[model samples]
Target: MRTKVSKGKMAKLLSVVDRTWRAAGFKIVQARPKLPSLSAAAPDGCIVKFSVGGFGQVRFDAGVGAISPGRGFHVEGEEGDTFPKAPNGGPDYTPDVQDRYWSK
Candidate 1:
């Protein structure tokens, strides 16, 4: 599911995520620098490997799609997570896409 995060606060949020991941010794790399598929992504979310505690090193995607600059961006942690199975036979993940909307 995606959340609408104001563009003004986007930088702050990205900074926090960057610092947190970097502090964890994770290097963020991009796949296609040019025509990036994941808008406002930390490099290529495809190569980001995150430590999921006992779950071992689970690769995660940290890119926001469907970007509305100055509005909000979408973030897809992973396909499964991004589109998690729904409960009570309801729809899957909210938005079914990872994106962030500008709250402001």
Candidate 2:
């Protein structure tokens, strides 16, 4: 079974993604909370979109190539917790998929 990510957690994740993309040199075209999409434009004028998948997974789409999550992308509990929480709010058993994407 899959669990949905909470709104607060989703916001945090999106913020992280925004920072990561900016650090990777992508310009943020727009990032609106009301909208379900976060759009960024590449240096070459290509627009990339990041959206929340129906199952609460992070999805990435780049016009040129396939994008996948990079290293160190995992969701953990509140700041004080030392371990990640499962979507079911139990022990984390979910496989780690790339949550952040960067161009090489």
Candidate 3:
């Protein structure tokens, strides 16, 4: 048997996979778009965007790229995946957008 999926579905699916891998001590490092503010206008249907140090950068809905190679296996998160919800209405999705910066 075989099954088909839509572009939206595929995007969501890929997000899930990336989330799962990150949870398992693996990092999906990718560069994501910068947001001016939480209350600012976001792209249409855009859930989140971020950048990974080693995996490069990517925008889930707008751009495309390869999944960053990590020290673990390949995985992603489903729609119902358990992730911390940021308070003050940060983003309307799981896996909060975060980044690591170092400066002297």
Candidate 4:
């Protein structure tokens, strides 16, 4: 998926996601553009993909006004297969955009 956000913006967002998620105690594994038919919402914007041990894979959709506002942060795919039970017992669809520095 091609995003309208610039590469610089994407890089910055990735750094922020890496730092934030790492600070959250999750091992910052890796990040990618799209998970390839994984996300429930195909948001072609700034997305941060990562793998936290025991949590499988996760993606953060940064609502940087690309395409639509954004899908915030969420995880699709089967739990234990593609992802695990989300943190805070939250649903797969989480509004993490409000919980990050990007909200500023």
lDDT of 3 by residue, 1-104 (tens): 01222333434435554565456444434522232111111233223333222222222333333445656464466344343445775533432344232110
Clashing pairs in 2: 69-98
Specify the highest-TM-score model's number.
Answer: 2
What C-alpha lDDT values do all the predictions have? 0.41, 0.64, 0.34, 0.38
Cα lDDT tens digits for candidate 4, 1-104:
11223323445655565667556555533445442211221133334343221222234343234455768565675243222247776444322223233333
Q: Between prediction 2 and prediction 3, which has the larger TM-score? A: 2
What's the lDDT for candidate 1? 0.41
Give the per-residue lDDT digits (tens) of candidate 2, residues 2-93: 23445546776678878888898899998876545688987866778878765455566778543456665555753543436877887763
lDDT of prediction 3:
0.34
Provide the TM-score for each candidate, comma-separated: 0.34, 0.49, 0.25, 0.29
Ranked by lDDT, the better of candidates 1 and 2 is 2
Candidate 4 RMSD to the real structure: 16.7
Clashes of 1: 14
| Candidate 2 Cα outliers beyond 4 Å, as residue runs | 1-4, 53-57, 65-104
Assess candidate 2 and give its TM-score to the true structure: 0.49
lDDT of 1 by residue, 46-86 (tens): 23432221212112344335534586555686344334467
